[model samples]
Target: MNARNAIDMTAPVQAPRDAAPASTWHSQMPDDKAMLRAAAELTRDIAVARPGIYWPDMLASAFVGYAALAGAILVSHPVAAVLLGLLSALALYRALLFIHELTHIHKDALPGFRMGWNLLVGIPMLIPSFMYEGVHTQHHARTRYGTVEDPEYLPLALMKPWSLPVFALTAILLPVALLVRSAVLVPLGAVIPPLRTLVWERASALAINPQYRRRRPEGDFARMVFWQEVGCSVWAIAVLAASFAWGWCPLLIALCVVSLTAFLNQVRTLVAHLWENDGEAMTVTAQYLDSVNVPPPARFSGLWAPVGLRYHALHHLLPSLPYHSLSEAHRRISQHLGEASTYRKASYPGLAPLLMRLARSTMTAR
Candidate 1:
C-alpha cells in the first residue's frame, strides 16, 4: 500500500514552543542532503511525467476557465451570471497555479507545458511566467527561504492585524495595478535606460514582500523579460481599446476574473506558511515546520491549493521535484521516516483552523 493510503492523514499535532524553538526546529531531523537523496532514490521512477496526463488536464482547465468567463458575460439571467463568475474564478485560479510549476520545472523537461501555459494562461492574465523565474529561485534557496530576501515568504505573524487587511486588499486591486504597470510603466522604462534599470530592479518582480527588490536581468534572461513585458503591454492596451469600443461591461467582467484570481492566490499564500520567521535564517527543519502541508483525506484542499501546492513543505524539501510527483515524494518520505517525523508535523488540518490560528496569534501579538 502507498504510505499516503496507509493511515488516516489528519493534521499532525504541533510541537510545543519550548520543545520546538523557532530557531532550532530541525535539530533532531534527518540531514537535508541524505533525506533528499533517499527521497530521490525512492521516487526516481515516478518523477517523470507522461505527456498524455499533463497536457490534457492543463488545456482542459484553461478552456473551462475562459468558457466560464464567456458564459458570465453572455448569460442574460442575473443568477447565471453570478454562478458563471464564481466558476470562472475557481477555474482560472487553478490554471494560474501552474505559474508555481513553471518556477520549478525546466523549459526543456516540459517544453510543451511551458509554451502552452504562457500562451493559454500567462499572456491572457498579464502575469507572464518569466517574471517569476529568478524571483522564485530565491524563495527556494537555503539561506533565503525565510529571510527578507525571499520575496514570496512574508512574516505575516510579525505584522499588525490591520496590515493583514491591507495585504488582502492589495490583491483585489491587483487588476488595475498590473494593468498600469504593463501599459504605462513598461513603455516608460523602455525609452529611459536609468528608469529601465530602476524598474527592472523594483517593479518587474512578482514578489510578496515589498522590500524584496529584484536584480537586473542580463543577456538571454533580460531579452525574455523584455518580450514578456512587451506582450503584456500590448495586451493591456488592447484590453483598454476593447473596453472603450465595446463599453464598460466587458471591462467589468475582465476585472472580476482577474480580481477573484488574485484574491484566491493571496489566500493560498496566507496559508502556505506559518509566517513564523522573524528575519532569522531558519534551519531546514525549522523552515519545513514554518511552512505547511495540507495532506490528503482533506479533499477540499485541492480546490484551494491546486498544482501540488498543498504539499508545500514537501516542495521545499525537494524543490526540483515536479508538482505531479510531490505526493509520491511525501509518501516515500513518510514511509521511510514514519508518522512522528518533521515531515508529518508540517501537515495542517484545514484552512479554517489554520487561519483561525493565525488570527489568534495576531490578536495575542497585538
Candidate 2:
C-alpha cells in the first residue's frame, strides 16, 4: 500500500524548544511507495561494497578501542584513566556497532568480517554478532516492524513517566547481566531443555522490547549461535578467573568500559525512535516517519551514533544499503526530494534535544 493511504501520521510529536519548530513536512512529502522506488534507483550503485572504506574503518576503530582499553587498565593516574576509559568506550562502541552491518551486509561480499568481529569484539564483550544478526532482521520485516513481535521496538512515548528511567537504568546492569547470561545461564541452558527453550526465546538476542521473543534457529544459523555462545561462555569464565588470580583491577576496567558503552547504546536506543506506534502495525512509511535521524550540524553525531545510525530513518527505508553509503544516499534524497519531504520529519537536532522531548512526552502521558 502507498504511504498516503496506509500510514498514520497523526501521532503526537514535539520538537525540542530549541529545534526549528516541528515541521509539517510529513503532510507535504511523497508517499513511501514513491520514496522507496526512487531510493532503489538512486542508490543501486552505491549500495555495492567499497571494501577500502569498510576494512580500514572497522579495523582502525577496533585497534584504537583495544589500545585505549589497555591504557585505561595500566595507567595509574585518575585523569588519564577516565580519559582512556571514555576513549575505549567510544572506539569499542563504534567497532561493536558493526554488528548491525553484519545483519544486512551479504556474507560473500564481506568475507571474514563476521568471524573477525565475533572473535575480537563480540565474544569478549559478551554480545556475539550472531545475537544481533538473528533478531535484528525481524525488526525490518514489514509485518513485524512496530508490533509486539519486533524485539527492537518499545512504545516508550506512550508509557508512564516511571517507565522511562527504568528503561535507561537497565543498561547499568548490562555488564553483569550479560556475564551471568553467558557464564551461568548458557551452560545450564545447554543441559536443561526447558531452560534452553527460555534462553532461545529471551536471552539469546540483544533486544529492547520485553514482550518480544525469538524463535528457535536451525541449520547454519543454529550452528552460528552455538559456537558464538560457546565462545562467549569461555571468555566470560576466563575473565572471571583472571580477576581472581590476578587483581580486581582488571575486572574493574572491563566492567567500566563495557558498562559505559552499553549505557551509551541504551541512550542511542532512546532517541532512535519516537516510540509512538503503540503496538500498532505501522506501514513502512509510517515506521520510517516514526524513526529519528540526527543529521549533520549535530555535533558528535558521527561519533555518538556511529555506523550510519544517525541516518536511521533512511536506513529503514532502504535496509540493504551499507553504512558507508547512507550519508550519500541521504544527501541524494534530500537534494532530490527537497526540504518539504517527510524525510525532514525524521531528522532531529541532536541527542539532548531528543531526550528532553521524550522526557516531556512521557510526563505528559503520565
What digit string (tens of lDDT, one per residue) describes model 2 on residues 1-366? Answer: 001112222223333221422233223323667677777888988988777877888889989999999999999998998999999999999998999999998889887888988888898888888789868999999878777889898878768878777888789788998999998988998889999999878877889888877888899988888899899999989988988998888788878898899888888888888876666666777788778788887799887799999999899998989999999999898887776666666777788777777777677663
Judge candidate 1 at residue 207 and give its lDDT: 87
Instruction: Give me the runs in candidate 2 sitting further than 4 Å from their true place.
Output: 1-30
Worst 10 residues of 1 by lDDT: 1-10
Candidate 1 lDDT over residue span 274-350, tens digit each: 88776777677667767778878766888888888889888887777878888878877888977766567777777
- TM accuracy, model 1: 0.91
Q: Estimate the TM-score of every prediction.
A: 0.91, 0.91
Clashing pairs in 1: none
